[model samples]
Target: MRNRVSLSNRLKKVASYLPENANFADIGSDHAYLAAYVCQNDPNAKAIAGEVNVGPLNSAKDTINEYGLENQIEVRLGDGLEVIRPGEVNQIVIAGMGGSLITSILNKQKNISLEVDRMILQPNVDAKELREWLDDQNYMLIMEEIIEEQGHIYEILVAEKCNSHQSPYSDLEKEKQLYFGPYLLQDRNDAFMKKWGGERDKLTRVVEQMKQARQMDRDKIDQFINELDWMQEVLNNEKNNMETR
Candidate 1:
């Protein structure tokens, strides 16, 4: 028998969002580790491992074969969501990519995107952009998580379709939630703090550099300053929450 495929802490967290008997498509499935894992865990679950590149597609196929899950998991060579037709799966997973690219993948196939019951996205960076796209697409943010693994922080976003009357942002201010996740802002976990703290420090240095420039760009500096202020407020709120508890 083939050895069971193991997933990193990041992929494990992403898998936690999958529902029972999940029939899902994993876009950009590099090695199909996640797909094999879900199938191994849930015999009823079915997965389509879609890869755009020849190298990764072959790797994914090898993984599926080694796992002896050929019957449960299907490996396809195609870009983004093109491999799977609309309504083929209830959930879609697009992880280990930038938020902008993930957004572009979903935007490219609105029919399949809207058809799925759920979508779990893990963006390496620009999660704020993903959140904004989800909002525009009317996908309700059902769950959000931040995890630190191998000295890097990653964010997982779980969303589902919502009606026009419903919104993903809830009552929270849209702008803040757009920049900082609505759920992540509420939790303010250590990973979230570290990520934003680093960003705040980086922006502070940029603002200082701009101030020293011979021909300063006031508009750009103002934008950076505004973002700094928002980060400060979020950090302060987290500190106060800890103090009160």
Candidate 2:
């Protein structure tokens, strides 16, 4: 029987960021499945599976040991980059965490953050905030992916510290690219549209409720309207562009 380690589409996409033979770390590594999988597939690759909590730390160890990858992949228990010493790895992956927490992890560990050449991030929410934080830290957005699995839409960002700090937006509005993702905007797939379309519906409902309320907050209503308008316009623009082509 083949020993198989399954990765969700989101994680599989995350794994694609790794080079042929990478020195990598997976922070918030829930099961260390990604790390173990990569090491097993690429014999030359080595990985650190870092987990802050005991439950996940134990899971990571079990997975690595099950794969007999103890030599190639190490399971470390510590918060964020605290598990990763500077120069230990060339690529870093932080997945299945909130954007703010991801930013905090990178922010709190300057030494480890500066040592890596690449970063692969999958923020469950608040991705715009993460993009902004990456911009400030001089990480260049090199690739972006939007994947839908089990009815959930996940976005992955692959960046590098070539340190140019150049905006990837290419004449597009910075605010729009930050909120909507620069590469994702250019590659508006079904998952991306569905995610923003659902957001638009939710915002529209909330705006309607505010209008129907006996007491209305003008500022909140205006904010929701503005967001709703932006989403609708983008969706329409995509539609128009597709039609013209």
Candidate 3:
């Protein structure tokens, strides 16, 4: 077997967010499939595949060589953004990673803000933290997408560097937008609603459990109840918007 693997339609949808004619980098590129796809599909684009782990790095190198794209795709073995020199690529795609790891990578690689034109990120969880990090760094949220694949919902964020803008949203809007994506809130897609609704239901169960536990701290129980309420309100708002529209 020649290391058989393929990109899912969801990954392709994330790749579609990249601009045409852009130089791109895929950080943590395990098999280099996305980089190869971009190079073959977009004539004006070039890509770099950066992998930190030895196994994955070798796999990426083999994939690039097998595809005869050595000239179009550069494979480097280093952590996060360390593989790419400043200004080497305009668009950076970091996917298949946890939200906290992704945020930490971006936080440590602040040089990318000055070097790259845009960032396309797909976080596995804690998307609110990643969005809050982007807001703190003055990055503008250009687009947000939620896709369901293999019975799971993934959020992809497309952002651009910016210096002047109001905070991510008004105080209430910020909380709701961070928990549910800003664009997804406006789009009100089925996947988005389903994901948030499921989360709300889970939180409701947790709140009920906390309330019934006689030993539970009052403060902690109150906090859980508050979160459950917020999630319920947000979900209801999304549902109402969808129905009216």
Candidate 4:
């Protein structure tokens, strides 16, 4: 019955990371599509759809009711992790938001953040910031995935408490891993290449445009140049690997 709700490919990828019998919270659940989909698939799963805004909260309720998953998925109206108490859920999912915002949300509820067994984050942008936050908070990256759908590319980061496993980032590769996810960089799948390739092209155009300005933003230009250099190195290395293969 709950299978009536359709999820996008990106959400499907996020859902794949969930455990078999998860008691989770979907923060910023926006219509609760993910919560509904997961609960429908896992009979043992229970979820809370947390939405900060009233409208989305109501929409989430509608979805739960439509799928007759009201018993399995509860809709809550609150900001970020405040929707659920610490230790109430073992896993949390925060998707379709900017990295900085997601970090802020996690920071605001450090207690709940620490208690959760796992977190699956899908940041729309500034993924580097999120990765850095995860490192600082001692959440080790367990898995990372990149997918392209409907002309858009998305990244999913799965992390667990540092004590649960080893940290994937090393001092030598830390910087690069934070910018381009450790697992994703190692994979360098078609989607990863496409996403970074597009970003590199966009930066090239911006750098040229900036040079033509009456007064250049030297600092910004320098930053963009550094990013371009790093991107070029990754692209060239991938090319070399492909040729050898």
Best by TM-score: 1
Sort by TM-score, top down from the best: 1, 4, 2, 3
Per-model TM-score, in order, reads 0.95, 0.93, 0.89, 0.94
Off by over 4 Å in 3: 1-6, 166-168, 212-215, 238-245
Error of 3 at 98 (Å): 1.5
Candidate 4 Cα errors over 4 Å, as ranges: 1-3
* Residue-level lDDT tens digits of model 4 in 105-224: 999999999878899999999999999988888888899999888988899999988674467888898888899999998999999999999999999999999999999999999999
Q: Write down the RMSD of candidate 2 (Cα, Å).
A: 1.9
Q: 1 or 2, which is superior by TM-score? A: 1
Tens-digit lDDT track of model 2 for 1-245: 54878888788889988999999999988899999878888999999989889998998888988888989998888988999887889999999989999999999999999768999999998899988988878888889999899988899998899645577965658888898999998889999999999999988988998999999999999988877888998899989998999
Angstrom error of the Cα, residue 79, model 3: value is 1.1
lDDT values, one for every candidate: 0.91, 0.89, 0.83, 0.91
Clashes of each: 0, 0, 0, 0
Q: Give the range where candidate 2 is weakest over 10 consecutive residues by summed lDDT.
A: 163-172
lDDT per residue for candidate 3 within 1-245, as digits (tens), equals 33433678778987899988769999988699898877777767889899889999899888878867788888888988888888888988999889999998987888864458788999988888988988887778888888899998899999888768655466757776787777887787888878878987887788778778869778887876777777677678876877999
lDDT of 4: 0.91
Top lDDT prediction, candidate number:
4
lDDT of 2 at 87: 83
Sort order, lDDT high to low: 4, 1, 2, 3
User: What is the C-alpha lDDT profile of model 1 across 31-83, one tens digit per residue?
Assistant: 99999999999999999999999999999988988888999999998878999
Model 2 TM-score is 0.93
- Model 1 score (lDDT): 0.91
